[model samples]
Target: MSHTLLNESNADQYRTRVTLLGTAGGPPWWDGSDRTGISTVISVNDDHYIVDLGEGWGPQFRKSNLGPVGFQKGLDNVRAVFVTHHHSDHIVDLPNLLLLAWHNGSDGLKSPIQIYGPGNRGELPPIFAPENREQLPEVFNPDSPTPGLTESAAKLMEAYALDINDRMRDNAKQDLRDVFEFHDIELPGTTGDRPNEDPTPEMEPFEVYRDENVRVTAILVDHRPIFPAFAFRFETADGSVVVSGDTGVCENIVKISADADMLLHECIDMDWVDTLMGPNSPKPDANLMQHMLAAHTSIEQVGPQAQAARVKSLVLTHLVPGNTPAEKWQQAAAGYDGDFYVGEDLMQFGIGAPRG
Candidate 1:
């Protein structure tokens, strides 16, 4: 396979900070259940860019001290959103995110946001199938078990709309027709729209966003058959961090994460999941969750990725079974001999200790 991952410079002219909202695939109810999906917010100064608003956003985002105007002003400060791929566990809250931003644009969420990702236009509604299948090459891989890049966000939303609507109760009244603007930012070579149908988009690999403090780079990784899966590397003046969305033993990821100060990767504690789910459990089904395991990375793989990249620390996110009730984060440290952090809802990590 052609690899595009590379070493990155975490250096910057200004400082940047990243925050974790919901870090598990299943929820993480405060009382202790599992349904909240993965969501993270990166803030450069007061400007915050919310990424992958999984399930628990309603409650988690509420944790922000920034009230209605806080959300709206923050939304106004956003630069753009870079999505890893389209998984309900990863982005189901996006529609709600837009709805809230639009509905509250005047007070809470500054509307007309711009989002970039692999699916059709901005996150596609799950069920979308173009009349011509060839148009979307990033999302469809017949050889893999999952839909990959081409999974229609529109279609997926349709599949889960009922469940979502039920939770929204009566408030699910609005139709979010034009909440946010969308840009398809795949790596070079993926879009046939360019000569010769390459797998990656043709845009500049690394970007200095509107804030300009942090540099972002997109790299293709192997979450195969899920066509068009990705990993992003973020660099700030203080340090660098790499986010591995979902993948299994991908060499390209090693390249993208190379030398970053920290790496946050999605992990499946295979041993834990196996022991917990057992043969009688109702999951790992032909349904959405089961399909994810085949292509996802396991904990066994994360340490090595960190070691190879020589990152200062390794953090784990988007965890399945979320290592609940079991010192999973500490256990992960056994794999590598460096600092490791496990993400939780509303968990905050900064460059250094909070001021005294």
Candidate 2:
């Protein structure tokens, strides 16, 4: 059945929108690529909410017209951030984001903004390194001395807050404590296809935080060492969309995202890489590509995954080398039965209603 789009009768539509701001490995540093690493901007009315702050992301945030003001309000509604993990590509840009958001001339947020992620939950795993161990403190809970990821996360928050507070004071901006909040989501299963992508990982299932009209669910999936990679199932008033962050072939995704309207998943070309590596005299560069080949989900993995989920459309992202030409992208994704498109940065998809 087709779901109805959610309408905020009290507010307006242009109030919020979702933009795929950055779609690269890390924010463009020297390559001059338009994409930034793994970033998504979800705007509600005029305010924007950002996901993941990869390296060099500051420039792109300004470029996307997400600078400060929203379409209606002088300052964007964007006051909150969600970080899925601590991977360099996923969070290296965070400090800059905090600095940018608190820029005096902008919103001048009165309270610390909320930053929700998995790492905010339990104690850091004993396996974490010393430098990162402090950053990944366990969440604070006097009731439970149980050293967990959250405890590690708490230590990190305290340290981060101390530093950030100093900067805010220097900038003469509002105290970050009044402006920054950290939330943690604990994903249950461990020690399987999923490992600690990092003590501070990215992601929240579709279910956790959403309006009545929207429901999100998270499922365990395989991204090999990128362990604990997620499959986000977004159910709206009208339809459902599944975003498989970055993963290899896995069964949990199929069960979680059954019957989605669209499945936007990352894609890599293992066949071509294999061909390159298999040749008698392989290029030295092919070795690295070969490793990336292992964890990332392959094109061959799509058809079956989508079919199993019964998705209506498929959008392939995180493209590997051969996706240059439209035909190549289409051809690469040809295995799937549904309508498919090659995704690019800033491409928009209207989810709720059809406008005249």
- Which candidate comes out best when scored by lDDT? 1
User: Mind giving the per-residue lDDT tens digits that candidate 2 earns over 282-344?
Assistant: 653454555555556666667777777787777766555423444655664555687666666
Model 2: how far is 251 from its true place, Å? 1.2
Q: By TM-score, who's the top model here?
A: 2
Model 1 Cα lDDT, one tens digit per residue, 224-292: 444466777776655666778877766677788777766778877766556545455554423333435
* Ten-residue region with minimum lDDT total, candidate 2: 2-11
What ranges in model 1 sit over 4 Å off? Answer: 1-15, 26-31, 66-74, 105-111, 120-179, 190-211, 275-294, 352-356
Q: Candidate 2, residue 99: CA error in Å? A: 2.6
Model 1 gets an lDDT of 0.58
The lDDT values for all models are 0.58, 0.55
Per-prediction TM-score: 0.68, 0.69
Cα deviation of 108 in candidate 1 (Å)? 8.0
